[model samples]
Target: MDHPPRIYCYRCRKPDLLCICADVTPVPTRFGIVILQHPQESRRTISTARIVSLSLTGARLFVGLDFAGCTALHSHLAAAPGPVYLVYPERGALDVVDVMAREHGWPDGAPTFVIIDGTWAQARKIKNQNPCLDRFERVSLSPGAPSRYRIRRQPRGHYLSTVEASVLLLSRLEGSEEAFRPLLEVFDRMIDRQLSFKSGESRRGVRRPAPRPEGG
Candidate 1:
């Protein structure tokens, strides 16, 4: 009889579903994260949402624009009186920088970040797909360090993987350099583990190795 099929950990790629090496500690914060993931991206095994969800307390991940199935996000926005800033670059005729500067002095409260979670091209598609989002103030981060996401290629320097952008924003807003450090570390470690696994699998002439026995 054939053995049960092996399953990879979605986040860590380990034979074990839950990796003990990965600490599931919590970060204390009140900031809310609104992740708008493209449908294709949402199903990928290595998407950044896994890390972002584990890192923040008020994190909400949504697959599309309608907000129909994303009840949590809808409720958050409906109840929130503060301004919502779409974290995307300004396109032709869409000047986010100007709006951000003008709304800087709003008396009510701090701004919430709405990140578009996809590649530069995919993100642009998201923006184009959702015209209702035109009114939101787009808060683009000035170009900086290159992304640490090794799997995907980005055009020139116009791209930042979602996690990198999140860390930068959190650092600037909350004044915490360590805001998303753990998540970044986890990502780096995951890459290293995946690379090692791939190298071994290549040598064995198989796509995947026999999984370690359960409780072994």
Candidate 2:
């Protein structure tokens, strides 16, 4: 049983066969996207957080369980052009669109969006551990098109993948659906590839399901 070590693409951190590096077409965004990904999720082959980071010029990915003492986190917060906002569904979390109307609209810079990329439980853990994030207003998105993440079992229909949520958040916030469309393009491509990979396995008569990592 001497299987060869899998060669990985450093840029996308995916195996060369499943690499998404070629599909990454960077999309410019008006607001900053800071994705705080749980360390475990970073190691997953189908990480959409990587796609969001790769496809958006304004996106920054930080991998950690707790960001309490992360220098880059603090520096990013300090350097935000406008108010900082956390995109988590919390009690009384305002709607992203409504926030614009309530504040009479941000003519210049919209708040930087901090998206926690993990399962619901893991997301809660990250927020609780990062007390610094408590200072920011929490905003949630109104559900859009149903999640296209059919590869996993989601608790609900609106439960989106990390990049799917990013597409909705950015497209709506910037008032241009077209700009963020590329994020989904890459997201869908990844899903298709994974499905194809599994099909190939099934053709060889593999019975077990592939592991599904939680994100968004």
Candidate 3:
């Protein structure tokens, strides 16, 4: 039998009751963000890329796998008032610390980060397909703690959700923790809300197993 279509919140794109849109004060950062999401990631209700888009002031999320010649995506980069950087590579990319030390424009919020959101395999495919993204200066993070996202299984303990990664990257690059607190607050709420909902469903004896989501 076909399941009834779930009613969704148009803004956050979550099921209406599961929406985490309350008290979301868009976090403003010195730098900008652009998320190139895999089409598959866009289908996951638990995906945090939407959270980054809704909770960040100057961030944008575009859903696709390849965007090498995407007119809009490339045009936005060209029009950016500052530089752009891609985030990836387990190694060899410039460390976030080094970029702060070496890049003069970054201090003035002149660098926008472009992140690819998807499963590890999917993110790899997206990057390989997009030459426009590969050509940018890539940046990597040194995780201080394990990922806080418990519901999803990460390929590694240090893999962070999209919002978490954005929060860490911007907070470090801009040199302020307090400025990005609201984003984390919202992230916690979403995780808590989902946890509660799932537990409640179990208590009610909904036997269907939940599908595992990929790390953002």
Ranking by lDDT: 2, 3, 1
Give candidate 1 regions above 4 Å deviation. Answer: 1-21, 65-71, 92-107, 207-216
Q: Write the per-residue lDDT of candidate 3 for residues 40-100, one digit (tens) a residue.
A: 8888778889888998887888988868668888888887777788989656799888888
Best by lDDT: 2
Off by over 4 Å in 3: 1-4, 105-109, 209-216
lDDT of 3: 0.84
Best by TM-score: 2
Put down candidate 2 lDDT per residue, 1-216, tens digits, no spaces: 345687999999998888998988978876889999998788888878999999888789999987888898889888888788899998999897777776565665667889999888888899999888899899998785677887876678778888988888877777888888877888888889999998997898757646677462
Ranking by TM-score: 2, 3, 1
TM-score of 2: 0.91
Task: Encode model 1's per-residue lDDT on 1-216: one tens digit a residue.
Answer: 345776766543335533423654566555567888887676555567656766667777777745446567767766655678788766533243554466574567656678988767777887887765677766777646787877666676657778777777777666677866887787776666666766886897775456678478
**Could you give me the TM-score of model 1 versus the true structure?**
0.76
User: After TM-score superposition, what is the CA distance of residue 110 in candidate 2 from its true location, in Å?
Assistant: 2.7
lDDT of 2: 0.85
